[model samples]
Target: MENGSRISGDRRPQVGVAVFLLKSSSILLGRRLSSVGYGTFALPGGRLEFGESFEECARREVKEETGMDVVRVEILTVVNMVALDGPDPTHFVTIIARAEMADSGQSPANMEPDKCAGWAWYEWAQLPQPLFGPLEDLLKGGFNPFAASRLM
Candidate 1:
């Protein structure tokens, strides 16, 4: 890990990460407080640091934001997010992954109150409205994170 040091190239598209933490039949979701996607539902992840792989980013972000340890970090898919609809166009090549808690009894907490309002589990079909940009694109593409039957 690069101690949360984000990548440098001025022109390189920023790398974002999100985790699909499924417990039983529900997946974890958090409401964003940051400017990029304020008040929208988002996965528990942050920017990938320099020299840090996507798996490391996911694990670290989950632990930091939810105070829970996760295992089985596997890449679900990648989304090329181009925010063309907004005035301030943004592009993030988000790497999405799936993970599970080490212990089922352990629940999530809002460790970073400034970045997220809180954490909760929601059914896939009943996800909250106004998801973060990358997540919105993922849902629109019909990318089901829980379905292990599909080949990514």
Candidate 2:
């Protein structure tokens, strides 16, 4: 087996949890510094830890990446991503969750400078160019965070 493949031959996709942290008409996004999606705008999220629920992962990731406490975390959608073209191809089952800041007046801080450039809020209709692949996939699938949040 290759180094990237599991010894047990398990081929299950890894799970990632992302938050759509909404503040009025804007949502939080950060420029990624990671190799996978470097320079692309993405929501705060990471791999779901063992035994952790989706909501728990969302809150933890948001806090870890942006240093902000989130509330009302709810699952909005799930995306099955298969990237077979890259040098290190991957398959990720990404969970998209919606949340709001616990303190409405609070702003995000860059908790992990190594992972993200910085955090900023952008209006849904005027988002930055070059979104992360999973996020772009989610949007292409017609998953509107604003519309979905309203139904929650």
* Among all candidates shown, the one with the greatest lDDT: 2
Q: Model 2, which residues run further than 4 Å from truth? A: 1-11, 149-152
Give one digit per residue, the lDDT tens place, for model 1 in 127-149: 99889878888888888887844
Candidate 2 worst ten-residue window by lDDT = 1-10
* Residue lDDT tens for model 2, 1-152: 46764323455789999899887888899999998899999999999999999989999999999888989888988888877665666789998899878998888999999999999999988999799999998887888888885333
Q: What is the C-alpha lDDT of each candidate?
A: 0.85, 0.88
Cα-lDDT of candidate 1: 0.85
- C-alpha RMSD for every candidate: 6.6, 3.6
Model 2 residue 92 CA deviation (Å) reads 0.6
> Any residue pairs clashing in model 2, and if so which?
none
